[model samples]
Every structure is written in C-alpha cells, then in structure tokens.
Target chain A: MRETGRPLLAWVGLAARLVTGIVWIVAGGLKITQPDASINAVRAYQLLPSSVAEVVGIALPATELVVGLALVLGVFTRGAAVMSAVLFAAFIVGISSVWARGIEIDCGCFGGGGTKAGAASAYPWEIARDTALLAASLLVASLRRTRLSLDSLLFATRPAERAATEGAMT
Target chain B: MSSNSKASARAQKAAEMRAAQNKREARRRILTIAGVLGVMVLIVGGSIGVSLLNKEDVKAAGAGSSEYGVTIGESDAPHSVVIYEDFLCPYCGQLERATRKDLARLAADGKVFVEYRPFDLLSSIADYPIRATNAFAVVLEKSGPDVAKKFHDLLYENQPSEQDPGSMTDDDLVKLAVEAGATEGDVRADIEGLAQQAWVDKATQEAADSGVKSTPTILLDGKVFQDGRTIQDMADNLMAELE
Candidate 1:
C-alpha cells in the first residue's frame, strides 16, 4: 500500500511544481520584458508609496524568477514553495483592495490584457486563481519529502549506515 | 557455507542501497537541468514575441524642404498656432484624433500656421532609450513639416495604452518616419546620430520657459489658448480675434 501511494504522491507533487513554476516564470518574464509597464501597473494600485513601488518593481520580477526556478528544480523546494505562497497572498490582497475601491482596470498579470466592461468583472477570477495557486504551494511546502527530489534523497540516508561509517572512521 | 551466505546477503543489501541513492541523485540532477533550461527558453521566447507584437511601423511622409517651416493653414490669415505634444500621452492622442481634421483644414487655408513640437513627459518616469521627442525631432529635421505632421498623427494613432508606459524604439521610430514620407536612410542616420535629440531637448526647455506645464498645450500667435477644449472652440476664438 505504501509503495503504491509513493508514486501517486510524487506525481501529484510534480504537477503542482510544474503549474506553479510555469505561472511564476511566465508572469515574471512578462514583467521583465516591459519593466516600465510593470512599474506603472504597480503604481496604479496606489497601495505602496512611490519610492517603495520603484524598488519593488525592480526586485519583484527577479525574485519571482529565482523562487520559481528553485521550486521547479525541487531544490530548496519547501522554502521556494513557502515564498511563492506568501507572494501570491500579498498579490491577492492588493487586487482585493483595488476591487473594493471600484477601480476599473486590468490587473496586468498576463500582460496588457484588460478586464471586460460591466458589473461582472475579472478581479474575482484573478483572486481565485491566486488563492488556488497559494494553496497548492502551501501543500507542497508542508509535504517536503517527494520522489525525485534532493530533499528525499538526503533524508533517506539510513541511521545504521551513518553509525557504521562513524565506527569505521574511529 | 552458511557464514558465507550471510556475508553475501549483507554485501548485496549495501549495494542495493548505494544503487538507489545513485538513481535518486541522477534523477534529481536531470530534473534540475531540465527546469532551468525550460525557464530560460520561456523567458527568451516570451521577450522576442513581445518585441515582435509591439513593433512600430516607420514610414517617411513627404513635405520636402517646405516641411521644415511649412504652415498648416493660411500663412497670413491672422493667427499662428503651435502645438507641443508627447506621442505617448493618451490625452494628446485623444486630442489629435478629435481635432485632426479641423486643424488640418485651418492650416491648409494659410490662416493658421501649425507648428508641432513633440516632447516627452515619461522620460522622468521611465528609462526609455528612445524619448518621445526624439522621433518628432528626427521627422522634423529629416522629413520636413508635412511628413512630420503625418508622422505625429501616426504616432498618436498607435499610442500605447495609458496604463502601460514606454516609448517606441529607434527602429520603430524610423519606420514611422518612413511612413510619414522621410527616407529610411536619413531617418536612421538622424536618429542614430542623436542630433534630433538636441533639438527635442531645446524645444522642451523653450516650451517650459514659455510656461507650458502640460501636454497638447496650444499657443495662438505666441499667446496661450486658454479654454480651447474643442476644435470648434479654438476656431471660434481665432475667428473672433480676427473679426
């Protein structure tokens, strides 16, 4: 039963990792390509002050790239997963604030794509996507040991083997 | 024989453990490399796609030497209007589309001489290699007035969304110039030389000196046109002054 479950768990982990990583990488790369546009989008939120927005605009994309790469590679997977969750949580909050204020503008997530005009909106959809991604990231972070990962191999080292090696060295 | 079998079993177990560890390590390395390469490919591919999608069309419009000082309307109809605009400004674009026909008619009649000075407002906000004014300066210097006017109209027509900020590239600017009637070589050389930039900077400083604070600032015979929101309002004011 454990053996059967192990492959299933690893497959699930792989799916989560790929989804989160691709989303982050695409989002980050888009922003980097149009840095000024990204900065303008951040400024439109008016959540952060000018100076802070400037710094955040410059650093956020690069940070996303690094975190996304680590998660996909399954190296420092837990740490990267946690960071991605936190970042998405912050983005959700920001989007919710703007939506609450009745500001009609695109979130600028998937580049220049804008929301439709009317009572119905894209804000809810954006928040929902981010929330779902956050959950998946948190799950991966908590379930640190997965098949085909460095962490699994490292933790799999046997205590008996370690003690035998120590005795031999002495 | 029993003791030998026990030793063989222990050795086999150790070997199996070592093989498992090696397999895991190999898989991990392969996955890592694949992930990194995938990311690099996405970034590079996405960037290229964006550049292609955002490519600007440059064409030089012909007004020839008369382009430099060519006035739009009546040369002596009693009013002279100069417009300072930034191509990236949404408001400027709006005004251009709304009032272009009227402005052209007024300029063609030689009654109102229209001068266009393209300036940049986002230069302070963003680090763009090609300033808004740079394109205008290039068109003005190389293509002449008629082409400059055409180029200016085309830019406003293709202005980026207000939510996004950035200027057109030099190549795109040159493409726009050629569409406006200036030779591609001349536009390229002028933009490359950066001489047009000097003219843009000087015009911008002069506009500031003349107390122009915002884009699409209209000056009538060296006087600011206050309250000229619409094209009709401007024409009415101009006619009223003449009457």
Candidate 2:
C-alpha cells in the first residue's frame, strides 16, 4: 500500500486534499476577525489552562489558514495532510472530553467566540464531522502522489526509484 | 535458461528492490521539505496572529461623553452614581434588574446623576457580552441617551444564560433597538466601524486604573461605595451628602 502508485488513488487524494484544505481555511477565516472570541472558544473545552487556551485561540486560526492554503495549492501535500490530521484529532479529543465531563459547549470551529456554548457532544454530528475529516487527512498523508500536486513536479522520482517503488508495492 | 543466467536475474531483482528503497528515501526528502516549509509558514502567520490579538489601541472615550456611557439626569445634579457594568454579567444583570426603576426615579428627581459605563471583562467568556457592549456603545453614540439606556436595559433583560455560545449577534442588537423606537442610523457604523471600541477600551482601562475590580462598581460622589447600594440607599446617601 505504501509503494503502490494508482492514478485512482491520486484522484482520491486530490478530493481529500481540497476538501480538508477548504475546511481549514473557512474555519480559520471566520475566527480570525474576533481573536478574543476565538480565545473563548478554545477555553470552552476546559482542556487547557486559561493562558494556554489564550495562545491556542489566537494562533490556531492562523496555523489553520496557512495549512489550508498549502493543501489547496498542493504545495506541501504530505505536511498539510499531517497537520490536518493532528488538528482534527485534537478537536476530536477536546469534544470527547467535554462530552465525558457532561459539559456543554460549542466547538467554535467557525465563529462567535465559543462562550457558554451548550453541550457540544449533544450534537453528535460535530464528532462525526471531525472523524470524517480525520480519515480524509490520513488518506492524504498515506498517498505519495496526488493529481495536480507540486510534489510530482519538483520531486520527480528517477526511473530506477520508480521501478523500485512499484516493486515494493507489489 | 542456464542456472548462472537465472541467478543473475535474481540479483537484478534484488537491485530493483534497493532502487525502490532509494525512491522511498527521495519521497521522504520531499515530504520533509514540505513539512518544514509548512511549519515555517505557520510560525510566521502565528506571530502575526499573536501580535494582533495582544494589541489594543485605546483612547479616552471622553468625559461625560455619551459615546462611552449614558448619563441620566441634569448635569448639575449634586451627587453622581457612576456604574461600571457588563450587560452579560449575571451579577450586573441582578443589580440592574434590582435598582433600575429606583435609579431612574433618582435621575428624574435630579437628586443624583447616574452614569452607566459599559465594560468588557468577559469578552473571553463569550462573544455576546463584547458584542452587546459594542452594540450598547453604538446606541450611546448615535441613538441619544434615552434610547441608549433603553437598549442597555433591554440587553440585560434578554441576556442568554452565561453558558450559551454565540447567542447574540449584531442583527439581534439592531432589531432590539428598532423595537425600542430607535433608528439604525449609523448603528451599524458604531458597531462595525469600531467607533466606540476605542472609547470602550479606554473606559475599561480607566475603570481598571481606578481600582474597579468588578461589575456594579459604583462611585457615589467620588467615593467608592464599599457595599452595593440599592436605590433607597442611593437616595439616602444623596440626602446625607447634601446635608
């Protein structure tokens, strides 16, 4: 699976890449306008210390934006995919913890400063969304190549390496 | 095929395996490069985010300025009650609900001038308080003192439970004002233009500077009222100060 080169997989990778990329950009863009609200949103989970939450709240949007742009442009496919996976996974953990604590909260993934949000887990759909995005992220990370990716152009494999890659896949 | 030739073919396969390993190595290099670059971009963007988040450009909202607060009663009222409040604060809500009419009566009688200063300590608790404060600031700026106080009371009356996330929006605020007989006229500007933000920020900063540590921080005739004062108490104090 690691070495296999399938044109079909490339298409799947592109789909995942674009979808995850857009989600990150949109989520980050919405929160950037209200940094304080963004901070509140981070603190909503009760997972981090207030000071730490403040930093994450202020910085996460920017990181998400950068990662999104990278993924959409297909500039750094593997790295962006990994970042997407980490972020989604972190969100999953946060939501799950809040649910476990019987605490109410909004994920604040979009906007509105995430304060006093009623139970986040009450909406199982959010958990489901993050899970799906996580899967997409993993899929993007696994594939060595994707359609319209800069990876192929700048990091083209030599014929010898290509043959070896195929061999390993087999 | 001869045995020697067949053996050579096996060796060639082994070489192909090695070449594949090399390709994997090269792929890793590419991934590493991209990952490094991605992290670098995030660092740059994050620094900008941090700086912007920490930055607060505050200015004096103005003395007796309607932009930062609303004044009730004649300017020359012998004593004044300056209240620093957050509309979404449950405590402030309690205080407001408790003494609203009495304070108005005091104002009507011109026994004391009442000023409500909107501050934002709980901006991190939820966006609504800040949003509401910003909206109130707008009302104070454009809608005249009467409408501003009305809008202010309306906000406390309608404040969602502290646990509700993203409850109030600018549209909701504008609608409330219109319902209370006020026009939108540049209300959007006051809210969106952040025209009142600097003033609110200044007021909040000054409140902090003046050792105001909590909501309902009331100053009666330039003295901090250690105990929360009710309307009756306020009237009594006015009389005492007059004497």
Candidate 3:
C-alpha cells in the first residue's frame, strides 16, 4: 500500500465505472438494432402497465447507449452513474418481481430477453449481476475524481498537476 | 483584550465559513443541473436518431405486400394457415419437416391456403438467418412463388447446423437455385444483391410487430393452435379448428 501510493478504493471505482459502461453499451447496442425485440423483452417483464411498458421499452436502449457512452468517456460520470444505478435498480426489481410471480423468462440483459419455460430459478443470478452493477454505479458516483476523467481535466488548472494526479492508469 | 469582542470575532469567522460552504453547494447544484440537461438531450437525440434509422430501413425495403405472408394456395380456399418461420432455427426446421407434406396436401386440395411468412428472431444472434431471409425475398421477387417454394425447401434440406459458423453464402444459395432448375436470368443477380437486406429487415420487423416471438409459429385462421405437439395432433387440431 505504501509503495503503490494510491488508494485501492479509487482503482476499484474506476474499474467499476468502465465495466458498467461496457455492459450498458453492449446491451443497448444489441437491443437498438432490434427495436421490436427490445420492446418484446420489456413486455416479457409484465411488470409495468402495457402502455408504460411500451414507453420504457422504446426509450430504454437509447438511454442506455447515451449513459454508457457518457460513463465510458468519463464525461458526466456522476450523472451517468446516476442513470446506471437507477436502471440496474429497476432491473433488479423487475427480475425479483417476476421470479416471485413464477414467471419464467430470460432477463433480456442481452439480446434474447424473452419469456420461456424452465428459467425461473435463474432469477437470483440475474439479480446478483444487477446488484453488482448498482454498487459499481454508486461507487463511481461517490468518487470525487478518477484518472483520465473529464471531471479531473476540468478541475486541474496546470498540465503538471493534471499529469501528476491522474494515477488511475490501471 | 475584551472577552465580548473576542467572542464576536469568532462568531464572524463561523458565519464566513458557512457562507463558503453554501457557495460550494450552489456550484455543485449548477453542475448537477447541467448534467441532467445534458443527459436528457442525449436520450431524446438518440431516440430521434433511432426512429430515423427505422424509417430509412423501412423505406428502402421497397414494394412488399402489406397483406402479410407469402401465398401458397388459392385465395378462395375456405381455410387459412399461416406459418411464421426462421430458416436457421432448429425447431422451425423440425416443424417444417414434420408438417411439410400435410401442409402441401392441405394446399393442393383447396381446403386451406398456406402462407409461409418468413419471420426472423435468430438473425441478431447469427448472420445466417437474416441473410437467408433476404435470399428468400430475392427469390420470391424474381422467380415467382413456386420457384421460391423450391428454394425454401432446398435451403431447409441442406441447412447447416445452428452452431455452424460458416452458414451458406448467397452465392451457394444462387447455385442451389440454378441446380433446382431456376432460369438463371437475373435470379442469381437478385440473390447476390444487397438491396434485399432492407427487405429482410422489414419482413422481420413486420413479424415482430405482429407478436411472432419464436420460429414455426403456426396459426390456423389467425388463431394459434396451442394443444398440438406432433403431426397427428396438429392435424387433429386443424380439423377441429375447421369446425
């Protein structure tokens, strides 16, 4: 710890931010390509009223893409983190609700999120993934700044100070 | 030193510290407000972009029957059977293999009109399925319905296993058509063309909009037959549905 000099917690938050962004981008990119399927995936949840489900389904992939890009680029990290946390929390609730209702479905975290038989027991793992993502988003939000981030770039006045402080290379 | 004056000085310093803290909070509020506005712009802008792409894809698809499904029998036929299918799906292949003869018989007797509506769900996962769907549209557009049916059957007969990475290319499919007695006039060109890619997307979109979720989704006069698990069961269900 002494030799490395930087705190491990900062590195953890940075890693979480990047990974969470990647997941969102991939999920959104895949779903955006197949909008109708994305809607059906949302419908599979059977959580929202049908009208609300339609709106959420149509808007979700686009929102994810934007948030993911912002987070990955370290532009508006806190805001993107906020969006990520909210989406993951919603996903966790959706998965849990469906599991409790005995509705068998694929989590649609990926492309083929649809209703099917025999996958009801897989809810816990799905919830776990979302929970992890939620934690990551929260951590990223709480951090004041990270290396290679836009926020740090804005705050640091001198080039030397910026170069010296950006220790988030890993 | 007067004790009262010292106490007042301390109180003034505390007030100044509180003022600075409030200023920091205000700046943070401003940053967060900008952040929210920026995110909203991204979401709305992205949604618009996606909508535009969807429209462009649909427009490029060009001349297709809004009537849904490719016809296989007399229009005046008393019964209607619509088969929603994805060529690369294993279960779809099974359903086609199992019910092909019966479906043909039903069509031949003028008892039912069959529609082989090409639906795509596996294409997002694999390139093969949508490419084949495009090829099907190309063949249908150029060589009439009969030759298209032949092409469809041949594709199924020689379909690569679902896991096979190197699925049939358009060239191979054109060759299949030529071998199946297709008059190689522009049929091959159509098969090899990229224009049908939009058509494939459109067809798949139409199917998805109609709520066709899986391959080999069978409907008798628009009603899904849920109780049938086998050929005999399907046949029995068909007969029962007719009444």
Candidate 4:
C-alpha cells in the first residue's frame, strides 16, 4: 500500500508540475511578443498605478516563462510551484476585485486583456480556472518527490541515506 | 558483550554523521533555491528597467491637444456621446454601419455632442489600423472633421476582413481620402507617407490608458453604455436618456 501510494502521488505531482508549467509558458509566450497589448491589458485592470503597471507588464511575461521552465524541468519544483500559486492567487484577487467594482475587463490570462464587451460574464470562469491552477500548484509544492525530474537527478539521495531510508520504509 | 557494545556505538556514530550530512544537504538546497529566487528577482527588475528605457516616445500631431477628438456637433450640446473605435475591428465596423446615419442626424440637430475617437488598437495584429488611423488623422488635420468623417465612413465601407487586411494598401487609403473630398496632392502624399503615425500611436495609448479595452465602446454622458446589446436597443436607450 505504501509503495503504491508513494509512486502514485509522485506521478500526480509530476502531472501537476507539467500542467502548470505548460500553461505558464503558453501565457507568457503569447504576451511576450506584444508588449503594448500586455501593458494595455494591465492598464485595463486599473488596479495598479501606471508606472507599476508598466513594470509588471514588462516583467510578468519573462517571469512566467522562467518559472514555467523551472517547473517543467523540475529543477526547482517547490519554488516554481510557490511562484505559480502566487500568480494564480493574484489573478483571482484581480478578477474578484474587478467583479466587485463592476468593471468590465478580460482577465487576460493567456493574452489580449482589455475592456471587452460582455466581459463581466466571464469573471466567474476565470476565477474558477485560476483557483484550480492554485490547487495544482499547492499540490506540486507539497509533493516534492516527483518522477522523471531534474530534481531527482541533481539531488539524488546518497547511497547510505538511500539504503537507510529504504530499510526504514520496509 | 564488549564487542556488541562497540558495534552499537559505531552504528550510532554513523547515524549521527549521516544526519549531519543530510542537514547540510538540506541547507544547501535551501540556499540554492534562495539564490535562484534572487536571480529571478534581478531578471524582473532588469527587464522593467530595460522596458522603461526602451519605450517609444509619442510624438503625434494631436499629442498634447485638449480637443483632439473628431467632433460632430456643438461643444455645448446637452447630450454627449463618445464612440471609441478601431478600423480593424469587425464589431466597430458593424456598430458604425448600424448607427452612423442616426448619430450624424442627432449631431446635426444640435441635440448631442458626438465624438469619434479613432485609434489603432490592433496595430499588433495588422498594419491597416495604424495606417487607416494615420490617414484619418491627416484628413482631420488638413481637410477638417467633416471631410475626415466622410473618410472614416469610406474606410469602414471598404473594411477588409481580419484575415486579409493586407488587401487595403497605402494607395487605397489615399484614394479613399481623395474620394472623401481631400485634394489629390499633399493630402494624398500625407496619407501615403503615414504623416500621422505617431499621433495614431499616441491616441492608441491614450485609449488604453482610459480603459477602452475593446473597439466600439460607446459612452453616453461620460459613462460606459450599458443599455443593451443590440444597436436598436442602445439607440432607444440613448434617446430615452436624452429625452
């Protein structure tokens, strides 16, 4: 039971890592080439000051890509997952705030965020998707032992430690 | 008994050494993660700095003007209707087709201050929006708003689909401007030369700054138009409001 559960959890963590990582990569890729659109999207939210919004617009795409790379390669699984969770949480907050304030805005998750018509109706779905991503990020953060990952290769347990751990497990 | 005691002591020492090594490894991993996070922060900061430094300066003809918009009615009209539009947007085209005559009539009747804000929101997707906006800018600057309004309508009437926006070239824009009553000399040259490109860029940024997310965003009395989806519904609502 223990062996089966451990492998399954690791696989689940791996899946979570890939899912979140790929999404971040796609989102960042879509916005990275269109700086004006990114800035416009950030501006449409009207949450941040203009200067701060510009900075976020410039930095967010690169940050997403880097975090996604880290997660996909499983180089820093826990750290990447934490970053992912933070971004998702921020999106949820932004969407909720817009909904509360009765502002019509596209969440701009993948790209093209602006004051789209009928945008108010999409807030709930955006929040739900982000919430689900947040949950996946949390799962990846807690379950640090993922299979087929750079972490395993880079930080494998020493022989003596492995033997000790295996013996204890048995 | 003595040998057994020594073996157990050696085993305990080995366990202690292993624990210490594991602790060191854990600390090193944490430190490594911290270093990586620090690098990420630096990257973000550097990117922000670079973007700010490399930002384009807006130098449009209408950059610092108070009344840069194309006005269709008296300044002190009782009702104010502002329409933000992009030439490349299909929905904007539809909206214009639906309400162009009514808006003009209302403006002409001295009942409303109708303003048309033409910007190039889709410059990233296609070049036509900026080109068309630049042509309109020249018309507005040289030929005046009446001619520019005609040009605006002409562009919409000849609007190309998003997939084939390249069909409309500089020549086509100049021809349309001429057809709209602008002369075929300097005005045509200005349209071809993209004389007002910077102005279009500035206006686009201004639109984004003002939270004009999508094209055809209509504002009635300085508020987002929330009357209804259909054009007729919106017109009825605006008329009711004005009444």
Candidate 5:
C-alpha cells in the first residue's frame, strides 16, 4: 500500500541489476577465452590445492557467464543476483587472504592474472570493486521486481489484471 | 433487491476465482525460477567434476625422480632452493640475472641445493617458450647439468624483448647450446630437432601440477620465498639466507 517511492526503488534495482550483470558477462567472457590464464590466475592465489584450483579455474567462467545472462535478461533475477553476491563475496575473501598472506598476484577478475612485479598495491582497489559489486547484487536480490525486467513481465500482475482482481475483492 | 443480491454474490465468486488464479501463477513462477537455478548449478558442478577427473596426477606419474626437473648441487646441502622459470618470461630473466651467481655459489659451497624447473608456461601466447624448453631438455640429456646450466644462462642472455619474442630461432638456441659447451655435432641436430620435446611437455605439466603457476617462483626449503618483490630484494634475500 505504501507506493510513494516504489517506482524510484524499482529504477534503482534496474540499475543495480544491469551494472552487476554486464560486469559478470565481461569478466566471464574474458576468462573463458584464455582458460589456461584463468587457471594460472586461480593458482596464483595459492589458497586452494592444485586440484581444486584447476577445477575452479575451469568451471568459474561458465558459471559467471550463466549468472550474467540470467541477471541481464532479468529471468530468475533474484537467483542470479544472489549468485553474483556470493561470487563477489568469495572474491573479496580471496583478495583479502592473499593480501594477508603477502602473496603478490593480480586479482584476475577480468582476465589477465599471474604473479606481477608490483601487484600487491592493487589488492585494496580490487577488494573495493568487488565489495561495491556485492552491494549492488544484494540490492538487485532484495528488489526482485525491478522495472523493465523479464521477472516483471513474466511474474508480476499486469495493471489490468490487478484492477480486475481488486474489483472482485472490493 | 433479489437481482442485486445475486449479482453481488456472482461478483464475489469471480474475485475469489481470480485470487486463486493469481496464487497459482505465483507458485508457477517460483517453480520456474527454482528449475532454472537447478540447471545452472548442474552445469557448473558437472563441468568442474569432469575437469578434475580428467586432470592426471603428474606427481604420482614421476615417482619422485629428477625427471620432473633438474637439480644443481649436493643432496647433502644444508638448504634446498627450488626455482621455476620460463625461458621467455622477462621477469624470470631479471631474477636469473640478479641471483644466478649467488645461488650457484651457495650451491657450490654445499650450503644449498638448487633445483631448476624449466617449464613452457608461456606456450599459450607463443611456441617459442616450448621450443626453448625443449632445447634445454636436449642439452641436459646429452651434455648434462653443467653445460645445461650454461645453456640456461645463455638463454636468458639472448632472451628477446617480449615485444619480439618470436625473433629468437631454434638455430639461435642451438648456437647457444654449443657456446655453453654442449657437444657441437649431435647437440645441434638435437636442439633444432626438438629431440626432447616429450620430456619438455612432461616437465611443464609436472611443474604446473606442482603448483608453480608463475615463473621465478622460488621455494626455499619447500616454502615460497616471498621476502621481496624486486630483483634486488630477491638477491638480498637469498644472500641473507646464506648467512
């Protein structure tokens, strides 16, 4: 019944959805092309065993791409947003751990990752970026009925339907 | 009045029916979302499972032998220094230039055992790394580690700029092998022919399996040596460790 700022909130959700969606697509696309580089990037973190890292390296890009597609299309928007949030949170933890462990590596978020000459300085910025994306994904997850979304088209009751239902109720 | 009451009852029935339809639609939407998420999870998990299953355990394949890499110095040395290097990696070159003599001296003095794992990590970008690694393997196989060590230094010395990496040819590597004291006659044929390419491939995979993802990954006594970032820092760290 409180509908004063509903449109504004929907617009915010739309923006959040698009931002995280496009980022995931781009990041996943870049990594998928160079899987070996991706694997090396995961290995650079030095957190997981080689076997686990290899599997993650091979599978992560596809997961990112699917999540991105779902969010961008606004189909299963909540589910995709939740997945995005989880991934960004994991990335944040990984970056923080590497920083704490004194390992120097590129975050490898958008592709090109390995041991670099002066990569430690970039960890803070990478964490900040992931944290921001995580926040945006959380917003999208909470506001599942964003404007101009497939969820709205497929799931939300249309104005005509709402009117008919309300008329019957009254 | 009777007609009015009948119409109101009909209207109430229609509303209840509409509400029921709306509920069903919401349930269907939730089910659809759940189904899509389930499919996504299956895809991610399935691919990861397949890849892990396919990934061979290279460590188990080699049986803890020097087939994985080349070791320099006495086994009885007080310390062990392991280095992973790619011939084409510029930073590896820099690190080698800085620490080559100190590491060798430490090894020769029986203070440290140095192991060099040359792998073709940059093969994704260029085949030159693989070729160079193959050449190193050939030299090591034919002439042994002393000449191979010289060949290693020479490769770094002739390392092309990353911009023009392909400029260095197999002939160039063969020439370096000869200069480094490998037997001139058959060594040239072997280096150019990539006679030890299989060994190079095996060693590279073994290095990767061993978690040497980046070049110049130095492990001191089986632990990552991360005391510094710069070549100077690495050089200083190695020297300090000797004392």
Candidate 6:
C-alpha cells in the first residue's frame, strides 16, 4: 500500500481521463448532429459491408458519448479508459488502411475538420495520442485507490484496530 | 507483553487494515468497471438497432444518388459534356442560365451531348432529398434527353431559396416531366420504379470515384474543365482536341 507514491499516478490518470473524455464527447456530439455524414464516413472506409457500416456508424458515436461521460464523471475510470484505448486503436487502423490505399481523405475522427497532409493521413500522430492515453488508463486501472475516489474513502483501513493491538502488546 | 512484541502486533494490524482497504477498493473498482462496460454494451447495441431501422429512411431520402454514371447524353453526339450540379448551389444555377443558349445551339446541331449528375452541396445545411438528381435520372431513363433537359431547366428556373427545403414530390416531378414532353405513363412508371433510385446511387458513387468533390464540375471528354471559359472558349478547346 504505497499510498504516498501513488499520487503522481493518480494525477496522470486524471489528466488522461479528462483529455480522452472531452475529445470523445465532442467528437460523438458532432457525429450525433450528422448521423448521415458519419454513415458516409464509415462507408468511405470500405472495411465493412454496407449493412455493417450503417450499424457501426450509429453505434460508434453513441459509444463515444457514453464512455466519454463515464470518464468525465470519474466513475468507472478504468472501464472508460479501456474503451477509449480500444476505440482509438481501431481508428488508427482504419485511417492507416485508407492512407495505404493512397486515399487522401479526412479520417472524420474529430468530425471532418482536422485533416492534415502526408503521414498525417496515415495518422501516426493519432495512434501515438491514443497509445499514450492507453498507457495512462492502464496505470489508473492498476492504481485503483486515488484520494478523491469513493473506493478510497469506503475502503480506508481501521487505524483504531492498529492502536488497540499496539497497546495490548505493549 | 514486550514493547517490541506490541510494536509487531500494531504493525500486523496495520497491515491487515491496509489489506482490507485494498480489497474493498479493488472490489469497488471491479464493480464500477463492470457497470460501465454494461452500459457501453447497451448503448452500442441500441445504436446499432436504431441505425438499421433508419436505413430505410436514409435510402428513401436518397443519400447516395449524386454520383456519376453513364453519360445519359444524346446517343448520336460525337462528344459529351458532363455537368455535376447541385440544386442548392447558386454557381450551378448560374452556369445553367449563362450557358443555356450555347447548350441549346450545340444540342440543335446534334454535335454535342450533355449529361447531368446531381451533387448535394447543401446536405450539411438541410435534409433535402437527392431527388433533383433522382428526378433527372428518371426523366432521362423514361423520356430521353429532351425531357431531361426540359426538367433540368424547370428545376433551375423554379429553384428555391437556399434556406428553404426544396424538394419535389412524385406528382410535382411527374407534372414537370409531362410538361417536358414525357408521356404520363412513362413518367409515372419511371418515378415509381426503384431502379431509377439505384441508378442515382450508382451515378453518385461514380462521381465520387472520378474525384468530383464540388458542384458544377464540368468534364469535357473525360478531362475536368477547370475554366469552362466562354462558350467560344469551350468550343475552341473542343475543336482543338478534335483536330
């Protein structure tokens, strides 16, 4: 129980949660506004069949919204972290595939606005961003007891028991 | 008891307390994780269902009809001019008006063919059906180029304001086609058939494949004409290519 040593990890966790949560929520909210555009985006990927593409388009945005909400609230931080990591990895792969085929198109990940050139199309930067977030999430998952967490307060050890045992032995 | 023993006891109790706390924290973490995962599954699953249900709506709305397809121009013409246009795009309407006389002269000489592909430039702002394109496809399929040209003129002539929802009902489309010299039965039948709808979708895909990202994209002999130039300029370019 190296409590004193864990604060730095917790801070990192907080930062990761905030960044990922905000991004997901914004991206998801944008997609929700234009579901058809989202669907077109999925179709552009050409990975999935049309039937599957439609379903993926709708579900992906909603998942982003829910996971983002959970992360922002600091409830289920570990779960949201994992979800965000997986989703980012998938997007990286999708973007990379399109880039490999020489398709010069937006990833539509941040809602069709942030399109860069060259290796940016391959989305190496995006993959790096997601990987860093995944590392932070994994750290939070490993270090489950942060100061402001409900788990920390509810699960605090009984100091009184330690004092009583010490007195009896003395 | 010895003081050292007492200290040992305290240390053990403290360790036990910490272990218990850790255990409880671990349980809570696990439970919260499970709960969030459950919600994620539900939400993702629900969205998939909604998307499938909305598929019909998207198709009915003609989400994929603005792409390029067959030239759909006059069969006897030596050269073809493909025009990609959007009903909401003022530039396309302007081109229609500006080039109307030149196009008519070419068509009258039977020396040039014109093909129309619908582009949805304002889909971001409004939910208008890709119907303008679909209507063109239907008219072209049923009543040929003359009727399509007429319907095209009428659409551009009666173009609605950019802010308003500019869609034509089946009846409205049919009436326009009738005015354009299409038989009532042909207009009714072509509009009713989903085949025309499919044609629009395929045409749109083709347009996208051809790297058309904007409205009023005019291609002469398969090469995009960035500057349509004047009618004379276009004719000169065509004559140069032919020679």
lDDT of 4 at B142: 89
Q: Output the number of the DockQ-best candidate.
A: 2
Residue ranges of candidate 5 with Cα displaced over 4 Å: A1-4, A158-170, B1-16, B19-27, B38-84, B87-144, B147-243
TM-score of chain B of 3: 0.66
DockQ of each: 0.05, 0.19, 0.13, 0.12, 0.14, 0.11
- Distance from true position, residue A9, model 4, in Å? 1.8
Clash pairs detected, candidate 2: A104-A119, A105-A118, A116-B163, A116-B164, A116-B165, A164-B20
lDDT of 3 at A45: 71
Q: Tens digits of per-residue lDDT for model 4 on B77-182?
A: 7888788889988767867877788777887888887788889877766788989999999998988888988999999999987767899999999899999999
Candidate 6 root-mean-square deviation in Å: 14.3
Q: Write the per-residue lDDT of candidate 3 for residues A55-156, one digit (tens) a residue.
A: 676688888887888788777788889889999999999889888876667788877776554567688888888898999999988876654566554445
Listed in order, each prediction's TM-score against the native is: 0.43, 0.49, 0.48, 0.53, 0.56, 0.46
- lDDT tens readout by residue for model 3, B66-119: 433467767678877777788887656766777677778777888777788775
Q: List the residue pairs that clash in candidate 3.
A: A108-A113
- lDDT, each prediction: 0.63, 0.72, 0.71, 0.78, 0.78, 0.62
TM-score of 6: 0.46
**How many pairs of residues collide in each model?**
33, 6, 1, 1, 0, 5
Model 2's alpha-carbon lDDT is 0.72
lDDT of 1 at A44: 53
TM-score of chain B of 2: 0.64
**Least accurate stretch of 10 residues (summed lDDT) in model 3 chain A?**
A1-10
Worst lDDT run of 10 residues, candidate 4 chain A, spans A160-169
* Best-matching candidate per TM-score: 5
What is the Cα-based lDDT of residue A18 in candidate 2? 94
